[model samples]
Target: MSTAVGGTTRPCPECGARVPVDERFTVWCAACDWNVDPGERQEHRQKQETEKRRAKRPGQGRLEEARRALARRHGERLHTEMTRDGADLRARRDGASVLAYALALAVHGVTAALLAGGVLCLVWGWGGGLMLLGAVLLVMAVALRPRLSPPLGDGTVLRRADAPELYALVDEVARAVGTRGVDTISVGKEINASVISRGLRGRRALDLGLPLWEVLTPQQRVALLGHELGHYANGDTRHGRVVGSALRSLATWRYYFLPTPRPSLGEMIVNAVYAVPLLLVQGTLSLLDHLTLRATQRAEYLADREAARTASTEAAAGLMDQMLVLDSIDVFLRRESNNAALAGARSARRNAAGAREGGDLWTRLAAHLASVPEHEYERQRRAGARRGHSVDSTHPPTHLRRAFLLTGPPAEPAVVLDEAKQRRIAAELATARAEVARSIVRDGVA
Candidate 1:
């Protein structure tokens, strides 16, 4: 007997895979890739062509052109700086790389001097009351240092035992890159990986994005992890600890120095008078921040170089491309996944199995991502490439990184997990995925 083609009950005639009928009236078996209509293919091609033409219109390239010009200018200076810095590092002087550190020290030193001078004035100045006021101003300057900690993402910490496969990979990368091994690993929903200092001991914590892991090939995953771990080896994350502390301190001091509460006219006068010295400190920090921005960008390139060395350059470039896609859609996908999970939670028991891909959140997300057409992905990739290396941007432009990677000698693939191992690693994270999804929904990622 011949199989029917129009209903969910029937399978595809050629491959016998289930062909679920939908309102679109396009008959096909997605599982076995059979019986796609010619009209549908033609329709898709036409739609893509139309979108492509629209994207290439005259005004479309205007902003990109301007950005590229600016990027070229910044790239020239960056090339010079990185060249010099690289030579210095090769000479074993990276620890003393010129930074805004000196300025940060100066800012703190000035604050202490002001406080000490104010104390002296309070003891012996012309008027005791005026000197007391000066002392208070100086004290406030020192107390209100910028103190924001880096954001610890909303997710669960997975110990080495819990994610041994991942920890093993971390160990391999750490050994290859010659950096301290990660002290802890956390699974989070971010579309990016980050290495953060965990405690007073500065033990490195590695945060991996589960969604990011889902999309990347094993080699690309190595590239991603290697890139983050590379930061430690390259001394970029270390510099971050130094500069970040200073920047945070400046912010804390700025906050205290800035007037708080609703001040009456008389109080406002006093507050404004006190703000004069505080503004100088803020201005000095701002200038230092401006000067050091390029150093941060160069650090990113240096880290990329390390990743390319550890993982193949191709994998590193592929990571940059994938990251562009993630940056574009991560929030949207997270919200959609949350919505799907919430809906599934409210469904009948029978409907639970009916939920897409056996009610797996990651599977549902993969399906949603698969629905984005190739051209849309290309569009975002191109857009990211065009954003150009701005001076203030921490990461260099994706195109620039790709270009730099291509210039280097090709690297052997550093990490490759067999298919079974990849599946095993993913299976180990199944429970964590559920926990993370619940966290996302609980935290209301949307």
Candidate 2:
């Protein structure tokens, strides 16, 4: 028998070795599982065998390699396209922010003018004074509005003085991305990390909370930071601040006209007199908030893509999963806290009963106040408290985000785990849970 190599065939030197030749001049020996080369006389035989193998294993190694090369090239192309798209988005957002600021200033200017006119009208006993006063109050409320800060900034660097391991990890990631180190890092109660830009010129800062440090694994923490850094890389932080400020201003103006109780009888009189104007202000603010939210949603999508690009998609997915788990834990804790509070209230009531025999004047007053229909008020109060929580909740709902990250392009499949990746993800989850348990044991979370 003859085998072929490189367009030639020759007799196999090794007897009893099964020599199979191919058209491409490749030879396979079955008995010894080695390739053999036979010189030119067997070339026709070699070609026929090669054709058989090609038919049997269509588009094997070389073809697969070509496909992979094409995919890598495509990925590079997409990265470039996305980078340019991100730049365009940043430019557009910057313009929008400037426009919003300008509009806010214009509104403020009009408000100032109206207030001046109102004062003059007050001096002259003009009927327009009330309308002008309402407008002025609305503007003041809008101008001084407060809101949850946007979750963007250069994150605080974990120092050796604070958390050595976390600091080291953050430094590693920062070096990998070739960015300036996080500007600041602080320990906070909420399980969140954010990048914030401050001052008129927007100096960047990173703020990390203590709960995240206590809860997340090093991988999870790095992933979370990468997501935030993605925001920074895309200039989302500065633009987010502008959007947040604009939304806050609108919300304030809306609240000014809404039916919240007045601080005093005189204020109530003024509010009642100018209710219609207040409603208009509130309506306008609500419209602005809707628009800002739309922009915010787009920024979130871009940031997610950036995170996936910089880190692995799996890492981004892991971070989002961790966020959802943390959110559930927070909700559970909040409910438990509320229950504890109710128990404390009951204990206080019993103590009051013991002290007063039945009910004293103060107790009766408290009972009467509690008996008033205030379900809406209580709900609003709770919502306000949740808003005041230090956690950076600027992102959309967790479940929605997870779905977005997990689903990738259909054509180029992601690594489908055959047990190993699944195990690793499970181990990570277990570690996170253990950390949370340990933190609870040590700190006795309230």
Candidate 3:
């Protein structure tokens, strides 16, 4: 449990122990970790009751149990290997990686062949239908080619000139993680943050989810930065255009191949015709996912370590605590945005037509976060553990990542957000925060 560092003392509601609670952060008893993720309620369920929603067949349960056991073993082995070499954070490739790469290359090669064949068909074919088929093939080839990511189109964009202090902080964190800082910062309403390479030039852009940012403390914020910057250092194959786009294209193909709902007689035949191609697409996706998942997970762990190292371990842990309440945050945002109390005030949304500020969504969020009782937080944590949820399917379990942080090497903050810099950064984000708030208030923050 994180002993509160620089915050004022407050009486713990649970044990009445004096505990330090940081402003705008997790308000929990440091002594008891009372409001922190307390797992499993003591209450028991009826012996006869079962969550036994049976699968398609009788033996399915046993098969699933075996699979779960195998997955658990695999996860344990990878965890052990990752922790084995603290200094070496590179995702070690096995035969699977090589096979995945070969498959990706083959996919690209097939696309090239399709384009060439299409051109040849167009040149040689006399029939209009043949020419049309050639044109379709060419289009498919072009569509399936590896491509760069496009602009998010939403969120307020902040450049170096717009937020010098924020950029300076990001640059410092990036330097710590051994990556050139991002060129642009896009702040939005989501409860997540990430760094992505944008455009053909691969300009790194930091996407800061404002709701997530507002709730974290200064050092925790630095840890968040560290985690994102560390992705740049850790080679994530899922982010690579070649493999990434290949996966996307396969998924797209699979979508088109899906059987028509409540199929007519002709549609049934059509579905049967596409069945093989659908299976091929699915199998390829599975192969690529299985190969890249371990490495992606490793990258996430390494990033967590970087977060712990760059910001302090305490802060990193605290950040995890904040993460644990993300569902709560989302619920709170949605509820508050739809509140009858705020309806009239929320009606006047800020837009391009005339910019009007929001109803201080961040402030309400902070208050809601602070107000969440220990019992509720405990319930959420326990539920999360049972769920074994991660940030994504590619990530390790949230509880596991939190445990990893605490067990990892401790470090002093290499990039601290002092109050002065914090205020300046907040000033930089104020307009955007208000914009996001207005959007949420008007649209109910989906």
Q: Pick the candidate with the highest lDDT.
A: 3
- Using alpha carbons, what is the TM-score of model 1? 0.67
Score candidate 2 by TM-score against the native. Answer: 0.46
TM-score ranking of the models: 3, 1, 2
Query: Predicted candidate 3: what Cα RMSD to the true structure?
Result: 6.3
Residue 179 C-alpha lDDT in model 1: 80
- TM-score to native of every candidate shown: 0.67, 0.46, 0.80
Per-model root-mean-square deviation over C-alphas:
10.7, 24.6, 6.3
Give one digit per residue, the lDDT tens place, for model 3 in 1-446.
Answer: 24544536768888988766545445556456665543322212321122253333556556655656655666666666666645466646667667777888777787789899899889888576689879988998877655466448478999899999999999999998887899899998888999887666888888998889989889999999999888777667776666766776677777878889999999999999999988998898888887777778878888988898789889988888888789778887777555633535433332421233255567778888777555445545555555453322688776677777777457778888899999999999878887888777656654
Compose the digit string of candidate 1's lDDT tens values, residues 380-425. 4454444445645667777666666666368876666568767777
Q: Model 1 off-target regions past 4 Å? A: 1-72, 76-99, 108-151, 237-240, 255-271, 274-278, 334-359, 370-374, 441-443
Ranking by lDDT: 3, 1, 2
Cα deviation of 210, candidate 1, in Å? 2.0
Candidate number that wins on TM-score, 1 or 3: 3
For model 1 the local lDDT of residue 245 reads 64
